[model samples]
Structure formats: C-alpha cells, structure tokens
Target: MSELIARYFDRLAGREDAVLTDLSGGLRRSVTGRDLPDLTDRVAGWLAAQGVQRGDRVVAVFDNRLEAALLLLAALRHGITLCLQPANAEAQALADLAAGLGARAIISAATPCPEGATPLTLEAAAASPAHPAPDLAPQTPFTLTFTSGSTGAPKGILHAAESFLGCAAAFNRQTGIGAGDRFLNVMPMYYMAGIFNGLLAPLAAGASVVIDAAFGTPTALRFWPRVAEEGITALWLSPTMLSLVMRLDRGDKVLPAGFRRLFVGTGAMAARDAQAFLDSYGMAPLQSYGLSELLYISVDDPGQPHFGSVGRPLDGVRVHLDADGRLGFSTPHAFLGYLVEGALIPPEPVFATSDLGALEDGILSILGRSDDIILRGGVNVNPIEIERALAPLFKGRGFCVTGLPDATLGQKVVLVFEGATARPEDDEIWARARQIVAQGPGRAQLDARAQIAALPLGPTGKIRRAALRETLAAAEGAA
Candidate 1:
C-alpha cells in the first residue's frame, strides 16, 4: 500500500542491496526491500487481478512472516480495508468472520477458507504485474484488527496506515529509536502491539525489523546471542515474554553490543517484575500504556524509571482521570471506528475507560480495571492489590486474583497460581496469600484458591483470566 509504513521501508530502497526484513527463526524466508515498492505494487496488482477493488474488505490470516506485512501494505495501497484473523482459526469461525465482515477475500498461506471466500497466496500476490499507486483517502484504515475477546466476542478495531505511522512517530518521540536501529519481533503481527510497536513503529522511524516466531525458555535463553547476531538495538516485548526472559535470563555481566533498549507492554506488568529486570540488567525496561482502540498514551523514560507508573503521555496525547479515577485520552492516533454490520461505526474515541487510575506529578499509575474488581459483601475489591501482595509467591510464574460467583457475598476472590509442578507447599502458600490480602490494603478476603498446572494463555500468549474464571466456575459447579 502506498502508505506510511511501506513508504518508510521502500522509499530508501534501490539505493543499496540491503537486507531490510530479516526472519530470525526456523524458516528465514523474508521480504527484501531493495525493490520493495516494486514488489508491493505487483502484490497490489495481484489483488486487482483477484477482482478485489477499492473500499473492499480483505482478511489476511497470515502468520509472523515479513511477507504478511507486505501483503498488508498491498491491501492498503489498493485503497482496500483489511483485517487479519488468526492463522489457526477454525474453518467455521474463519468462515463466519469473513461472512460477517462481508470480506471480499481471505489471504493466507495454508489457512482454509469457507466455500464462498477467495483465498490468495503471497506467491501469486508477488508475481502479478505492477499496479499504479492508489489515490488514498486521508483517513481510510488499512489495518482491521480484532481484539483478543478475553471479555466477550471479539470486535474489530480499525486503524489507518497513517494512524500506525503517527503511533510510530509518537513512540519515536519518546524512545528515540530510528535509523541504525534493528527491532527484534516475536509478537504476532495480526494484533496492535506486534504490528504497530514491533513492525511499523520501527519502520516508520527508519529502522529495520527482524521477525522471529520462536519464543519460550529455550528461545529466551538464546535471545542475547541472537541479538548479537542480528545486531538488534531495540527490544519490543509483551509482559509475559518479558517475565519469561527475566526469570530465565542467563544474567550476562557484559551485554551484547547495541542491545541496551528493552520495552514491555501489551499487558500489565507488575512493579516487582519490572524492578527485577532492571536490577538484573542495570537498565529499566520502558513501560507503556495503550489498547487496540487507542495507543501510545504514555511511555516511561528509560533514564529515570517510575516504579509503579506507565510513564508520561506521549507527545500529542492527553490523559485525564475522571471523578471515579477513570482514565481518558485524546489523540489523533485513535482508531477510526469499530467494524459493525459490514459498515464502519464511528467510535467515541474520547470515551472514558473502565480502568481506575491515578496521576501523581504527571505520572500515571493504573489501580486496576473497574470490570476486574470483585464486589464481595458490599465491599469493593481490587484484584491488582491481591496480585501485588502475592507477587512473591508466584516468583516470576504468573498468577491471577479474580472474582467468582457467590450467592451470599455476591462475589468472592479466588487466587489461581501458575506453575508446572504442584507444590507440596501450595496449601501453606494459599493460606499465606489469603492472610496477606486480608491484612493488607483493600482488606480483600479470599474465598477459595487453587494451583493450575500452567498459565491459561490465550492465542496471543496472554494470560486469559476469563478462561481461568470459567475453569474455576466449572470446578465449583462440579463440587
């Protein structure tokens, strides 16, 4: 797509035979940007050949490949709005999604489509004849991303390539990551964090990206070596990934050259986890705040780290809290709207969030999500308070303190611990956590608790508290 992100990459091409997009893992197939404009134009031509036209909807259910990113560009260049579904989505779900969105086509390498939708491969998209640049509308969204649906059914969040470019620019204003910076990407490209923070953010600032799908302990252990190999200067990661790497970090005394920068977001990060990484690495990871609907609201300063806050608002972004401490942001980078009934419904971008937060000296700290608070016996309970109190028990392992249905109390607090081994000391630990929560601030009482064999993670590798709630509810029902 003759859009902001693509222009950032391909604009500097044809001057040098540079390896722009580097795939770091098993399959190193990549999108070389030497003639990237030419490739994207051909891909746009391929979409034209497929009978897709302007104002059309296309869903690219692609994996973490860099080519997938290019196809996104192609879709945008053709003046088409595009959404990406999970590559591993069930056929029926994919079909239902496509049918619901009235998508003209589905693009993927191996994902199956229902009988009605057209599926195209990157090979065909790349081989077709070149098409002319589009006369793009100012505010048309090039990327259509669906939320993780942790709370309910997923809703589409629309963002223009211009929005992403603006997001990148805002981020660059804070972090100063630009030319000569190589970002290592492991997060899924289908979502906001991966696409905006991992891919587009760097490219928009004249930086290259290294896409690696591999993760977990083995990958985390080998991370710095790979950073050294790839000359990666910046790190973009989710909190879960950061915790994993922090727990299993080899504790290198002298770090790899140009590997100083690290960032964590896409989910909440506990103060202890953030502190641990800083203590180990001698540099604090930059903490940030945002969601798919709006992003880059605040980012931490790497020099003087705020222990509990998500840092200050980005340039051109304003953050204010309501009477109830609910946070709201006003930014030009906000989403266009949510896709509904095959048409775009304008979003209330200035809408207040359900999050309870506070600002102290221009720094923002989130208390917790209002929806995550448990009402027990007319007492409001913030799960984050309990989570913080029990952070030591988890020891880099994940845990969640949430509410469960209770007839008498209206709701009850339940602690679910994440681990592979069921500790013989679990009963004692649960008792300790309960006592701590009861004695601590919030005066939250635990009704019951259990240890899970592993973290109930969603498809995005984020801990799914909704799934945990369901499991606990089912167990209670069985009892």
Candidate 2:
C-alpha cells in the first residue's frame, strides 16, 4: 500500500469494530473495519489477476456503495490510479473518458463496459484471494477526478495519494471532527466533496459514515427523519439541499440531539434562507468554498460566525485575488495536474479559479463566477450582489439572476425564480425583482423573468446556471 493508505489503516488497525453502514441499493449492511481491508485486498488480487498493474488507470462507474469504497482502497493499495465516473454518465461520455485516460479496466455497476477495456464485476472481484498490499511512495497518483463538464468535456484532475489522504486528515483535525462523530454521506462519490470530505475524511478521523444513495429533491423533505434515526453528527450539504430541507415545516418533528454543525458548499446560500434556517434550527449553516483542483480552500469559523463569508483559509492554503478579482489559491493539497489524451500535464504553481471573490481581514467572500456576471452596456454586473438584494423579497423560494443574450446589450439580466403561485405574466415577482436590482450597486435592470416549478440543480446540488440560461433563451425564442 502507499505510505498514506498504510498510515490510515495503521491508525485504525486495532479498531476492528469500527463500522461502515451501507445504505445503498435499499439494503443496510454494517461492515467492520477489520473485514473492510480484507475486501480491499481481495479486490486488489482480482485486479492483479486481470493483469492490471501499478499506475494503470481503472474507470469506476459505481454508486455510493461499499464495493465502490473497497475498489478505491484496493486501487490505492496496489498503486493503481482509479478514475471515478459518474454513475448516470452517458455511455458515449464514459467511453470517451475511459479512452482518454487509456483505462486498463472498467468496473461498472450499471453501465456497460466500453470497447477495448476488460470488464470486472464487484462481487467477483471481492471473491478473489486476498493479496498482500504493496509498498508505495506518498506522492504516487492514486485518484483521477473530473470536473462537472457542464459547459465542456470534463477535465481530469490527478491527486497524489499523500496529498489526498493528508488533506482529509488535516481537515478533520482542523475542524475537530473525530471518532465520536458520525457523518452521513449524501453526495455522489464522483465528486471530490463526496469521496474526500464525506467519506475518507471522517474515516481517517476514526469516525463512522453512513453511506446512502444519492440525495434528490423528492427525498429531501423526508431525509431529516432518517438522519435523526442514524444519529448523524455532521455532513456537508449544498445550498439547494439545505433550502429544500428548510421548506419542511418541522414544527412537531424533532431532530436528533446529536445533529450539529451543518457545512454548506458548492454554491452560495441566499442570505434570507441562511437566516431562516438559523431561526428554525438554532444554528447557522457554515458556508465553505472549494474546487475539484483544490480539495478545500476555506470554511466559516464556528467560533465566530460570518454570515456571508466562507471564513479564513485553512492551514497551508494561501488565498488571494488576481488583478481581475478572480480567486486564485495555492495549496499543498492541490491536484497534481490534468490528464490530457493519456499524457499528464503539470499544473501551474497557483490555480486561478473562474470564481470572483474578495479577501478582507483574512475572510474570503465569493462574489460570483466571473462568467456568470452580466455585461450590461459594458458595465460588469455581479449576479450574486443582485441575488442577495432580492433574496429577502423572494424568501423561501428558489431564485437566481442570470444573463440572457440580447441585441442591444451584450447580455441582459434575467431573474428566474421558482414556486410561483401564478404565471410569470400575472405574478408581480418580476417587477419586484426588477425594483430590487435597480436599487443595487450597478443599477442593474432586469430585462426578463422566468418561473419554474423548481430550480434545476446539478448532480452535486449546485444551481445549474448554464442550463437555466438555456431555459431562458428557449423561453425568449418561444415568446
């Protein structure tokens, strides 16, 4: 095993009773830590039998199951690089990604094996002989994650074993999350937040995690009861997920006393919703900022609550803004580089993110994405600033400010909101939104309004602005 994986296992060696509950596939099975490594060994043996060797890339298209975690550990133990593909990814996209990585094998639970790659089953792989773990360097590449691919093809981000494991351990220690905590994993494994924060970080701290199927809006309302039942202590949630949870009137329903410390990430949470959640739950959800390239950048300090800031940078993470106000960060935990056409390209010393933010008194507040800003008559209008201004007017409802293509200006500001009681033409919400934008800094003018049943969300529970823009454009064309 790589030094990092070996060290993690060593930390929990005597804690054989450490439990990992698998709530995937509608079945609950608690596997002990002692047996978990055996499963990983069996998977490693199976990969070896399939002629897979160290540094070979293996594509995994599985959900948040025990087997998926086992496979990931096995790959790390044997020095094989594992590329996690989203379970719902299209066949062609999976094929293209696997081909681009030159994956030696594809272990899929639902998707079919792509051409030229050997297919491996989780059950069969777990039945193989338990092979001894291999010794590996700390900097060995063990994981290759991809971007959301919302606008273009997903870019592969390679993470070294030591950096990946070290970041989780450091985050856990920094946050005071230890063996006493029980985390609930709701995010998909393909995302970095899912694999690192939700699963590995908790486990590294000797804490147990409850793995469930991917969370959806339909299940959002009823999820709190299960969380209470599971005695979940902490978990990372997105703004949209928290918003959906806030919609539930938990007047009579009592949450578990152990539940505390809700961390929000992926996107900004509306100020009104954040305040409402605090009023209802007696605790403000801590907002954080991070990216796939950098595991974690900053988080709100629990001791001193900053309503809109994503808190100070974590230890060893340097955060600054470029001349364009784009957030740039350098961290030891940053990914090695992007893998392009089977070749590894070294990353820059500092990763300049598309996000625009400001750091004041060591606190980082994300303004909005640079690309999401509206260019009204050549004046850059920050959508987040406008959204914050309109949040109170549309409290408890999903709303976003996006730019739509226009002839007169480069792009016009459009307010797309959710849960309208009437049609967009009849409701006064648009006028109210326009009035709020007019009062903002840029004197932003809303050119259009749209109403949907609910805001569209990406896999990680982030608002899909590109998709919403497309929806607005389609509506304009039809009008």
Candidate 3:
C-alpha cells in the first residue's frame, strides 16, 4: 500500500489550487498544489520542534477542524504515532488515555499546555508558515483510536500509515468517490471509520469534505440544508442518527434535496431500516461494518446490497471464519501493534475479530458479539437475529435486545426500547417476536422459554445491558 498520508500529500501536490473548505461558517479555505507542500512541511517542522521523533506518540484532542486534519497528516508524514482523542472527552478520560498510552506530546486547541506533555496550540500551528517535510520511518505507527471497551475503560488501537492508505483504497473501490464528490464528516475524528472515510478518503481522492464541529440530530438536521445548498454528493451517518432522521416529521422534506450515496456505519444497521431510508429519501443507504482495528471491513454497494448482510468486504480485504466460527480478516490496512508498557507491541497481522460471522458464497453475514450469545436452557440465542426480527415490526423505532441471566434457564433474552411510538400491545409484540424466532436460521437452538422487557437507555443512546440485567435479576429475586 502507498505510504498513507505522504502518498495523499503527493497526490495533492500536483494540483495547484483545490478547494479545501473548513465549513465553520460555510467559509472556504483554499489549498493550492503549491501551498500544500509548504503546509505539510510546516506541520513536520512543528512536530520536529516539539522533539516528536519517528514512532513517538502525539495525542491530538480537537474537534473536526482543519488544523486537526493538518496535525494528523503531518504527524503521519513524520512517522510519529497520531493518537486522536475526542475533544468532548472528559478530562479524566483524557488523563487516563495519556497515562495509559504514554503520550509524549499533545496537540490541542487549548491555549496553555496540560500538566505534563508538550502542547501545540491549534491557532498557532495553523498560523505557522509552510515549511519542508521531515524525514522518518515508513513502518511506524501513524494513528491511534480508542474503542469503547465493555470493561468501562477504553483501549487504544494503533494503526500504521500503510493501513490508513489501504483503508482509503478500500473505500475508493467500494464507494467510487472521486474529484467532484463532497463528503460530510458526520462522524468524529476519534473513530477510525470517521477519520479514514470522512477525512482521509475524501482528501486522498482529491474530493472536498465538510467538517462539522460536532455530531447530533440537530446538527445533522442543520447539515441537510447546507448539503442541499452546497451540492454535496455523499454523506456518512450512524444508525442512531439515521433513526433520528426517520423520526423527524420534516425528515422527508430535506433528505432528497441532495446526495447521491449515503454511507452508514459504526453500528449494526437493520436491512429493513436501510430499505426504509432508500424508499423514503430516494437514495440508497450503504450499510457497512467497521471498527478501530480494521477501519472498514464490509460495505453495501449501491447496485448490489445483500440486504441483511453488511454487504461485502471492501477491496484488498478478505474475511475468513475459523473452524470455531469466529470472524477473522486479512486486511491490507492493518494497524501496528498497540502500545502497552511504554513500547509498541505489534499486533498479529491476521486479526480474528471478536465479531461472529459466516461467509456464504462470498457474502458475509455478521452475528452479534461472539462471546455475548445467550444460552437459554442449553440452547443458543443470538441477539442480532432477534433484533433484526423485532426491528422491522416496529419500523423507525429504537430498541436493543440483550441477554439476561436466569436461575431456571442459564440465560433469558430481554428487550429494551427507547420509546414506543408504535405502541402495539406487549402480547402482540411478544407473539410476533416469538414467530420471528421460531422461523430463524438457528431456531432449534432457542429453548422456547425466553423473556423480554422494556428498559431505560443511557444518555449516549446505548442500552445499559448490564444494568437492565441487574434490574431483571432483582425483580426476579423479589418475585
């Protein structure tokens, strides 16, 4: 694969004046072919000045701003490991990350430096004149993204420059993005998919990107008007945001205004929901499965989406299932080993993802987390299959299915819903859910003794499965 960001720099080097907009107030910040080299050089110089040697970690904590992008590319060009944490992340979280990852320098919008590390102010760095690129290693860690760990603390997943470039290549092959296309950076820079597709992929193809300050339903609703006015060609969204738009009364009026392709990832997307978005907006929702480890694994292409599947694996990426039925991959874009104890520990090249999946005639069918399966009285129950079934019945509704421990049957299936706009009777919904389960691919595995209940969700819109399970257990004990 090409040397990640440097290769992109070379790609942009040829073009003299290309429009690179910041979109803070819909302002356009032009980047010329000539000025491009200088900007990268200045970034390299800044890193060098801060003593950021090749392979060293440089943590960036900022919004999806232009300078944040510059810092990322520059750090990669210099072979410095780029650790991008969320701007809105709590101070405790940031401190924990810094300590855990051993971050030497930090690049942020903060005027003054943090307690221990070297701080590169966002305003100053962007204002600095362009200079020359620094010399560095080609096989160094280029980026770091934190995955939401079930244990409550997040783990930093590292990546090489080549891996990011490979991601760009996979995205380009899957999405067919090119020079005239424009992408809206709906996802945050902290997430691997967002950083690669929303930022790097667009720039690598010489396409323009609109960087938003934050991601939310209100912000996304505001974004639609801008997209229509600016003639945006593509967009990326999370399943949560998609659900929000579907819930909007004014959603129909704004969706079809502009946009050729809509790429959705970062969570499981039901096929029925994808169809709903397409039918309502007159645009196809390209669903994909991706993570911090392997950027983007699968994509639902415009012409040929496999409906329920996460589409097919992107170009230069191969998905395999082990004899044990766990999902593994051979991705061109593979990250360097994570930094554990002040040193980089290279990850195994062939990553066996914790996700469970199967390949039937080249199409990948993703199940829920491999170890998270519910065992109901010696029977196996996959939550995803249940969710997929329940999702369609309550179309445009928000719900999460999880496993609850039961004294009688090892575990019982439970359902937690956000709100019931389509308020069918519980008995009716339960009957439909049972019908769906009785006709599933692994129907024999269900014990026919599963139970479900509606539970509250956290502020982040994710179901607190553990809490719900605890509530169930407590209620069962009382009964």
Candidate 4:
C-alpha cells in the first residue's frame, strides 16, 4: 500500500498540472501532468469495470499511443499485474504471452479481442471513482515482460514492485537525470529496457516522456525536429536505432537544439558506432548491460566510456564470475522467473548469463556468449570477436560468423560473407581473420576456418545465425 512506486504515481496524480507527452504527434506531443492522473484513473476505472480486481492479470495490446502509457500507469496504480504484448506481434505470440500471464482481460485498439479474454477499449474506459488504494506486497508482481526470443521462444520475466521502483532509483543515481528533463521513447514498450528504463524510470523521476511507437529511418529523421521543438533533453535507443540516427546525420539535423544525454543498449554496439556518435554529435553515449531478468544492472554513465565494455555493476547489484568464466549477475530487480505450463516459477537467481565476461579492476569486459561459441579441436572461438574483426575487412560488405554442427569438434566455425570483393578465396579470408585474432585475445587458442558467401540478416538487421548455420551445414555436406 505504501510502496514507493505507488507513492510516486500518487504524487503525480496530485500534481495534475505537470506535462507529459506521447507519440500523438508523429514526432512527439506534450501532455500536462494533470492530464496523466485523470487518464491513469480512467484506465484503472476501465480495468475495474472489466472485473480487473487488484493484482488481476491484465494484458494490453494497444498501439504505441498514449493509451498504452495510461494503461501502464493505471495497472501499476491499482496494483494490477500488468502484462504487455507487442501490438505488432503475430496472433500466436500475443496469445502465448497473454496465456502465460493468466490475463483476465486484454486492452486493444482492435475490436473483438482474442478469445478467452474480455476486451477494453481506450475510448470507452471511464474515470475511476475515489477509492482507497489496495494493499499490495512489496514483491507483488507489477510487470510481466517477455524477452525478444531472438535466440528462442520468448521468456516471460516477472518483476516485483520494489525491483521496478529500484530501476528508476538506479537510473537517477547513474544518469543524474531528474524532473524537468524530457525523454523520448522510440523503442517499443514491450521491451523490458524500453518499458522500464526508458519509460518508467523517467516517470518515476517525475520527468516527461514522449513515446513514438512507429520507429524507422524516415520516422527518426522526422522526429528529430520535434524533439528540438519540444525541448527534449534525453532519450534512449537500441543499437539499431543508434546506427540509423548516425547514418542520417540525426544529430546535425536536430539533436544539438534539444537533446542532451543518450542511452543505448539491447545488443552489442560497435565501437565505430559509438565513436561516430561522439564525433558527430559531441554527445557521449552511455552503454548499459541488462536483460529482461534484470532491469538495469550496469551502465557506463554519462561521460564515462569503457570503449567495448558495458560498464560497472549498478549500486546494490553484485556481479561475479563463476569457475567456468561465465558472468553471473545478482540484483534486487532480478525477475521472479518464467512461466511454465501456467505456473510462474523462479529461474536461477544467480544467472549464469549465457554471456562470458571478465571483471578486472572494477571494469567488466564482455567476452561474447559461451552458448554461441564454436568449438574446433577443443578450442573455443567467440563469433562476436570474429565478427567485430571481420566486419571492418568487409568494409560495407555483409558478413556473419556462426557455429556449424560438427561431429568431431562439436561445432565448426563458419563465416558467411556477402558482397563482391575482388579477392574471394575462403582460405584467404580465414588466414586474414586468424592474423587479426592472433594479435587479439585467445590468440592461438582459436582453431577456425572462414567461408565467403551471401549472408542473411533478419528484419532487425541482426545476423540470422540459425539460418546461416543451416546453410553452412548444407555446404559442408556438399563438400
């Protein structure tokens, strides 16, 4: 009943005159703080009308409009367990997430909400009557987020109220950003990072956020000017967005006028991209490391550059390395666990994050993923390291490295290349990559080969490692 998160929203409700914005404008729109409280109340009222009792599982599938934000705050304020499914996901994916959350009802812009659930439209929700706030466990479920499922089926991560609150506190301490700051939300709200750190964190800090659900190169260019017009100070982006903005000269076009701090994550950002951001915009990008399981565990912070590193662990979080050299993380914001067959469970609290990294002198250096590594002749080869090195060699040519199944070695290294280079020998590329690796870490320990061919990328620009592996396997069989 007295949770800091609840108190935070209650405070915002009292200050109804404050301003918050959303993607209502193609770029951004300004909404007064006063309107937020009423909107939140109405959304909660709508939930109540739909038999959404406190702590009831309520899923939202509305477009990336302000209504989504209203639904989020409403559920949090009323102590409703909030589960958000991406509006753009396939029907099956949305159904799976809703079922996993045990959703009693789902809010959507579309009519005839999926079966097994009642539908509440944003346009019909009424204002909540004055009522005493419901009592809730400090560890009560607030948000149930699903992972991107890039590597596999998405996993549902449950977060308690305190852990959700702690993210804002951690962000405040790490970024020194606070009230009066304006934030732009470009990434989808379904993402743990986007919803929590990018949205809730700023809200908890009493700052204004502008949500833009439709994200693309053209949309980004169009939005930059609005950010300046709105006097927005900070924004968060994924690595993909960062690359697009840089290429579009987004900073030169608009950022210098209104934007200040930049936060980025969601994948490994290239050093070149970071450097390009700095050189062009004069804004130092803060890199963060976390997952759906942990909200915001570590951050590079403003002006602090660890180059390839994601940065030190956040305050009140512990990061350790296991005997196998895998990175283990413990934090207050860690998820309760994923849902399995209708039951919420607890995963390994001490996450052996498929990621491998080293902690030296308080700086954490990610060494790629242990799960994705290829083993050749009993030696481990990190595809990420190889990709980073080989990416430059291609020089605009597309390339990806992945592990292919091998009976003798467990997994054989396969490099997929695209683009016409005058020099097109598979053996030659292998020799060159090896030379680069020889000078880098795990020098002689890596036994790998390279093959050049057309590589495929997913819609998000990520290498389709799984598909590439299959193609390479066929090639190996032909050989």
Model 1: per-residue Cα lDDT over 29-128, one tens digit each: 6555566667778877877877678788877776677566677766656678777766676667777777888887776633354344455655776768
| Best candidate according to lDDT | 2
Ranking by TM-score: 1, 2, 4, 3
Which regions of candidate 3 fall more than 4 Å away from where they truly are? 1-5, 16-19, 25-34, 47-53, 110-123, 129-131, 151-154, 249-258, 393-395, 419-479
Give per-model CA RMSD.
2.6, 2.8, 4.2, 3.9
Model 2: residues >4 Å from true position, as ranges? 109-126, 149-153, 249-254, 418-426, 451-456, 474-479
lDDT of 2 at 230: 89
Residue 202 CA displacement from its true place in model 3, Å = 1.3
Better of 3 and 4 by TM-score: 4
Please provide, for model 2 over 1-479, each residue's C-alpha lDDT reduced to its tens digit, 9 standing for 90 to 100: 65668778766554666557877777787767777777778888888887777778878776777667777777767788988877776767767766777887777643344443455666787679988887786678888887757778667789887777767876776677888888898887777777887888888888888888777765576678878888999988888777777676455545568987788887887566677778777887888878888788888887776888887788899986889999888888888888766677887888888899899998988889998888988989888888778776765566788898889998888777676455554367677777777876777788877677777877776788887887778877997
Better of 2 and 3 by TM-score: 2
lDDT of each: 0.74, 0.77, 0.68, 0.69
TM-score of 1: 0.92
Q: In model 2, what are the clashing residue pairs, if there are any?
A: 1-134
lDDT measured at residue 381 in model 3 versus the true structure, 0 to 100: 79
lDDT of 4 by residue, 1-479 (tens): 65686667764655544445665444444457666656666776667777777878877775556666767777776678777665655667667666766777766632345554455545565435533456776677887766556577767678777777886788677778887688877666655665676678888878777776646766567666756776779887777677766666534433546577888876777777688667776777888787667777777857667767787788888897888888888787777788656677786768768888888777777878887887776887888887777766655456677777778877766656565453556567667876776787667333544454556653335566666776767877898
